[model samples]
Target: MYGKKYLFFISFCILIIVASGCTIGESPAEKMYEHLEQTVSLESGFAEVQEPLIEAEQKEQELFNEMLGLSMKEIDKIKKLADEAIGLADSRGELITKEKESIDSAYEEFKSVNGLVDEIDEDTLKKKANELVETMEKRYKSYDDLHNVYMEALNMDRELYEMMKKEDLAIEDLKSRTEKLNKKYEEVLKSQDAFNNLTDQYNEKKKAFYKEAGFSTTDKKEAS
Candidate 1:
C-alpha cells in the first residue's frame, strides 16, 4: 500500500510540473519604454516628411527677398521656388494621413497603458506617467489644429496669388484679399508657436521618464 501511495504522489508532482511552465510579465518600466519607443518612431517619421515643407518655405522666402531688388526678369525663379513649396505641401498629403492614423492609434494604446502603469511601485513614476499622457494628448491635438489652419492658409494664399495672376483687379480689392490672407497666416503662426512650446514640454517630460527608468536620455532628441 505504501509503495503504491508513494508512486502515485510522484506522478502527481510530475504532472503539476508539466502543466505549469515558467512565465515572465514585463516590468512597468519596460512597458513604458515600449510605448515611448513607438511614439518617438511615429513622430520621427512624420517630422521627416514635414522637413521638406519647412525647407521649401525658407528657400521661397530667400527667393522672394532677392526678387524684390531684381527686375521682372528674375520673376521666373521666384515663381519656380513658390511652385516647389506648394508641390511639397501637396505631395505630403498621403504621408500626413498615414501619420495621423498611426499617431491616433498610438494615443489610444497610451491610454490603455496608463491603467497598467499605475501598478508601478514608485508613486512619483506613476504620477509622471499621468502627466506625460495628459501632455501628449494636448500636444497631438494642438499639432492637428495647427496643421489644419496652416494648410487652409496655404491654400487661400495660393488661390489669391492665382487670382492676381489670371485676372486684373483694383488695388483696393487686392489689398483687402491680401490683408485677409495675412491674418490667416498670422493665426497659423500663433498656432505653430503654441504647438512648439507644447512639444518642448513633452520632450522634457519624456527625458524625465527615461531618467526615472535609469535609461540613457542622450539618445532621445526632441521631435519637431
Candidate 2:
C-alpha cells in the first residue's frame, strides 16, 4: 500500500511539473524538460508543465486568423482607392493637353495676321497683334490654374495610397509575429510530449526496480 501511494504521488507530481512548464508557443514535452531542469524536487519538479505552451499555441493561431482576415479586407479597399486615383490623373492629363492645343491655335492665327504687314495699316496690324497676345496670356493663366487644381487632385490620391502602404506594412509585421509564435509552439509541444514519455519510462523502471530488490510489490501496488 505504501509503495502504491508513492507511485501515485510521483505520477501526480510529474503531471503537475509538465503542465507548469508548458506555455504558449512551447510544446508540452519541451516544457516538461525545462521544469525538471529548473526545479528538481518531488513536489515542484513534477508539477504540470504543459499549461502555458498549450495556451500560447492556441493564442498564436487565433492572432494569425484575425490579422490575415483584416489585412485581406483592407487590401481590397485600398485597390479601389488606387483605381480612383489613376482615373483622376488621367483626366488631368487630358485637360492639360487640350489647353495647350488651344494656345497653339491662337498663336498661329496671330502670326498669320501679322504676316499681312504690307497689305494692312501698321496701326491696325499692331492693335490686332496686341489683342491676340492678351487673349493668349489670359488663356495661358487659365491653363496654369487648372494645372494646379489637377495637381491638388493628384495629391489627394497620393495621400490615400500612402495610407494603404502603411496599413500593408502593419499587416506584414503581424505576419512576422505569428510566424515566430508558430516556431515557439513547435518546440514547446515537442518537449511536452517527450517529457510525458520519459515519465512513463520512469514509472516502469520504478516498478521493475522494486521487484528486483525483493520489495513487496503487492503492498505498494495496493497502497496506490
Candidate 3:
C-alpha cells in the first residue's frame, strides 16, 4: 500500500494597504498580487477533497490485507472485499478529478498575472516577477506529472483488486501485479518529491519578489 504525502499549500502574509495620503491608483505589483491571491484562494478546497481520498485509500489497503488471508472456501468474502475495493477506487477517481479541476482553475487564475508582470516599472522587480512566474509554471507542471503518475498507480491497484476476485488466480500472477504496483508507487513518490521541491522554490521566490516590490510581508506563523 502507498503512504500519503501531504502537500504544502502556498500562502503569504503580504500586507496590501493604502497609506493615508496615497492616491487610489493601484500599482502593477499590487494588481499582480491580487491575481495571485485569487489563484491561491482557488486551492482552499484542496485539503477538503484530499482527506477523504486518503481515507478511502487506507480503507482499500485494509481490504487488500483482509483478502490475503481468505481461502478458496471463503471466496464469497473475497469477492465482497474486492467489490468494496473497486467501489473505493471509483470514488478515489472522482476525488482525483475534483482535485485536478481545482488545480487547473488555480493555474488559469495564475496565468492572468503573466500579463500584469510587464506593467511593473522597476527593472529589478520586473525581472524578479518574471522569475516568479516561470517557477510557478514549472510547479504547476510538476503537479500535473504527479497527478498522472498517481492515477496510473490507482489503476494498477484496481487491477490487483480485480485479480483478487478471480477464483483461479495464480499466485505468480498476483506476485507480478504486486511488484508492478510497488514500482508504480515508487514512481509516484518520485513525482511527488519533484512537485514539493518546486513548490518550495516557488514560495521562496515569491517571498523575494514581494519584498523587492515593496510589499510588507510577515510570515503567517509570526502573525499568528
lDDT of 2 by residue, 177-197 (tens): 434434443443444344345
What's the lDDT for candidate 1? 0.56
**N/CA/C clash count, model 2:** 42
Ranking by lDDT: 3, 1, 2
* Candidate 3 TM-score, true structure as reference: 0.87
lDDT (CA) per prediction: 0.56, 0.37, 0.75
Candidate 1, which ten residues in sequence have the lowest lDDT sum?
A: 5-14
Tell me the deviation in Å of residue 138 in model 3.
Answer: 0.4
TM-score of 2: 0.30
Best model per lDDT: 3
- Every model's TM-score: 0.69, 0.30, 0.87
Look at candidate 1 and give me any clashing residue pairs. Answer: none
TM-score top scorer:
3
User: What is the lDDT, from 0 to 100, of the residue 109 in candidate 3?
Assistant: 97
> Tens digits of per-residue lDDT for model 3 on 85-181?
8999899888888888888998999999989898988999999999999999998998899889888888887888888889998877777788778
